[model samples]
Target: MTRPPEPPPKRHGVLRLWHALRYSWDGLRAGWREPALRQELVLGAVLLPAAWWVGRDAVHVALLALSVVAVWVVELLNTAVESVVDRIGPEWHPLAKRAKDMGSAAVLLTLLASGGLWAWSLWAWWRG
Candidate 1:
């Protein structure tokens, strides 16, 4: 006779939260392990507060925070791509280099956007 299928596992609310926290911690640790991430984090910490100080309005503060978050988010994604690419082929393949370059370009775009936002905010604050 064929065995019956097992029931699906049930997750408690606390268990779900714990799992999420665990994953977040893992991601944080991974970021810490990467030199590039550390550099970005340091830069974000410096620029974000400076932006807030220059703007000094609630809306400006929020926008600055969002920009900083965007930079960190992109860097994390780029790191993930680099990690996966390296895992797939540790050798210096042209494709692997291209993948890494694309990730870097994405980060550059984010930085440019952040810079533009800061410039506009500063200009507006000075004018008004």
Candidate 2:
């Protein structure tokens, strides 16, 4: 006879929040294994505090911080996509290539946007 299926996982209230946090932490740990993500995190470490100096006000400071964060967000997404594609099997597939390429493109776009924001913020701060 077949065994009974496991009960559905909890998905509400404080338990859910705790589980979500744990999952997010796990994701970060996985991301740390990626060299590109590690590099970005290192840069973010330096830039986050530097934002205090680069920002002209609270809003600019928050914007600066978020700009750095946006890069990490994209990098994590790219990592996830690459992982999934690689998991699908070692054999090359056109669609897999496309998906990976698109994910990379997304990361590049986020990097560019974050860079632009930082540059603009620095320029505005310096001129003042």
Candidate 3:
């Protein structure tokens, strides 16, 4: 007979939150090893502070900051995808190629949108 399925790890309330935070920190640490992610972080360092200057008000600053955050989110996910794909095998495969391409496409879309928002926000600032 087959054995019973194992239960999920039990983490409750504050413990769960702590684990989540730790995992997020770990992910960031791992992301630092990636060149593209490192560049995005450096870019974030500049954009996050610039948001305060480029935005006209609180909402504008928040939007600008979030837009930069969005790029980080997308890039992190892309890096995750690439890592998984590489882990599967070193040999070339069509499915692996597709997955990596899709991840890159996602990053490209996010970057374009973020750039557009910054451009529009800056133009608005320049007008006055």
Top candidate, metric TM-score: 2
**Tens-digit lDDT track for model 2 on 42-68?**
999999999999888899899899989
Question: Which candidate model has the greater lDDT, 1 or 3?
Answer: 3
Model 3, span 1-128: residue lDDT tens: 99999965989999999989999999999999999889988998999999999998999999999999999999999999999999999999999999999999999999999999999998998997
Model 3 root mean square deviation, Cα atoms: 3.7
lDDT for 125 (candidate 1)? 76
**lDDT, candidate 1, 35-64, per-residue tens:** 877988898888878876777678878888
CA deviation > 4 Å runs, candidate 2: 1-8
C-alpha RMSD values across all candidates? 5.8, 2.7, 3.7
Tell me how candidate 3 scores on lDDT: 0.94
TM-score of 2: 0.88
Worst ten in a row by lDDT for model 1: 7-16
